[model samples]
Target: MSDRLFEHSSQGVSRGLSAGSPGSGRRLVVEADGGSRGNPGRAAYGAVVRDAESGDVLARAAERIGTATNNVAEYNGLIAGLRLARELDAAAHVEIRMDSKLVIEQMAGRWKVKHADMRRLAEQARALVPANPTWTWVPRERNKTADALLNAVLDGGPPVWEVGASASTPVAADPTGRPAEETAPAEASAPARGWGAEVGGATTLLLLRHGETERSQAKRFSGSGGEDVSLTERGRAQAAAAARSLADRLGVAAVVSSPLRRTRQTAEVVAATLGLPVEVEPGLAETAFGEWDGFTFAEVGQRWPAELQAWLADTSVAPPGGESFEQVLIRVRAARDRLIRTYGGKTVVVVTHVTPIKLLTCLALDVPARAAYRMELPPAALTEVAWFADGAASLRSFGVPAEVPEDGEPIHG
Candidate 1:
């Protein structure tokens, strides 16, 4: 065994240790971090342990795992750090830190992990320590070593130990380690959004598209210009019918709507049944179809075949004076952030357009914007998003129940 691992190594033998010395009742400090390039892409986790007294690191670990999420990576990190601490059988306690809020929350019992992948990962992480330890959720800024280890795995670097201060068998890091870097400044405060606001309570948003409009029936492109378009008689009946069907099921706390007349009219019907006023969210407006506004599908496909093709293939393509799907995504993301930030953890009914609804679906699916064009939204439709506090969002339901018919008809919306 290394002399430094003994109870009476000279201070010179463990000069770098800062937290504690090599004696009984000493505590351990652990830092763990995880990363995935494409998120659900290639993933890795890393962790390191330093002697409390001499401040010298004792052991280093990193693992390249199969495909996993950022949360999965984080759990693996916790697992790695826990295992490292376990190897030091005499250590009475450990102070742990990580960058993932979900891991911190789930481990802290403040959030529920419903995904099978995360559930398994969480079980493994719990297997590390005895289900409890001193832990904190630090931002990416404070976690340098573990973050570096994760990056090393992602950057095509050699195996985990190729760079860290790990070479000889259980050796001391140095007589005096390079002075610790200045501690990162504290991050500006940000209130929790979505699910993490409360312990075990998830904030859910019920997203519903507006009822049919004249443009919807005509199959014309309706953008910002159709702000004043009124719903047809059929549309009005559809909204009222949907309201009656949804009222008993969705105990909506608030009714939020787009500023457009069609959307406002749709909101009125839903609000009437739910007994809530419509709060206008201007950011959730539909795509500005520009010169393509009021043009039927056949007209656009005929007159602007090349432009239309480009728009379909590439989300950035704009038809004459209209907005691209990318623009719509940016705004809808802002709208989602705002709503989740403002009414977090509460069920809010968002009555809006097809494009915005599809955007929410896309965000939940985490797919590219081009994929939105492939989404089909029936009028007066219902979709549900369970927004988690960890900045993670989930799609629980899409397009309402198939049994939900349009108006009196048995055809589903």
Candidate 2:
């Protein structure tokens, strides 16, 4: 029986015998678990090391990791487990069991550790156990012991341990573990972190495409260069529906819009309903189609087939005298940065045109620039993206109609 099992601290064992001590050759199994109530909210981890031969609990470690992602918490648990194992018997062969497939796969070198924070944590855990202990991914149900300990610590229960248990005789256990599936927030609404594991609330943007304009209905090119067009009557109705859908629901800190008339008109409706003023962002304007402005796709195809094909094939290709998708991305990226800086951790509603909306959606989804061509967002459709402190984005919902009710009741946007 390890003497270190009974002692406890948030950072793992506070007192322990020397490593590689007498009777330190026994194999060990380390099970670890971690979670955050709100994902990026309050977070903690728990780990338990046991004798592989006897299943006797050797040591337990847990700690509150403050605001962090679930991935970060999982890595912390692994680190704590490895540290506890080293204290008990540095030379013992250890098997690490965790429910996190990403952690296990990354540590095993089978999957790429793309996230910077996760890579750092994985490196730390590896440094502690230089030989790279056997990594195994178990289902959450199989890691009940550590899961319970984690929840206990999170619930403010003091860490306790029952060491020196009879290997063959099972004793009474205080298993108060809850399944992670039942406890964790659904992935859709949960704030996502970046590779750097951004902490704290995100700057959420409720991106809204403006209602249809005459140019849009006519299937003609409408760009910032053309005479700014207003919404049609149907477009006006769509804007009103969207405004009512979002006004009380998003809790918008500010309402921002494209400088163009169509977007401004849509923004006005939302601002008026929400009782918030509209801030014009020129960067959110439609693509500058230049000579192609007001021209139908068929007309452009017939007149400038080569140029049209080039523009379609490449994001850097612009119309005869206008901006490219790449250019739009650059300015939109800047706009996103400025907005996040101005309204960090607050929800902001952005009323803009199709190109900018698609570009922003691509950025949030972390896809290629060509992704804009693949997506179709209906007018007055609401798309959401939560930008974290570290510049990572969590795409919540996409193309949700503003005025549509799913259950016959008005839904808070």
lDDT of 1 by residue, 360-384 (tens): 7776654555667787887788898
lDDT of each: 0.67, 0.74
Angstrom error of the Cα, residue 57, model 1: value is 29
Q: Write the per-residue lDDT of candidate 2 for residues 1-413, one digit (tens) a residue.
A: 44542344332221223224344456788898899999787777888888787786777765555567899889878877886777567777677878888887787677898875566667667766634256667778778778877776576543322222312232225344443323433342224444545568889899999987888889899999888889987788788888888856755799999999999999999899999999998888899999999999999999999999988976656788888785686568658767876898999999998898888887776555677888888888999898775445778888887564434333454
Which residue pairs collide in model 2, if any? none
> How far is 227's C-alpha from truth in model 2 (Å)?
1.6
Give me the candidate number with maximum lDDT.
2
- Minimum summed lDDT over a 10-residue window in model 2 is located at 162-171
How well does each candidate superpose onto the true structure, as a TM-score?
0.53, 0.52
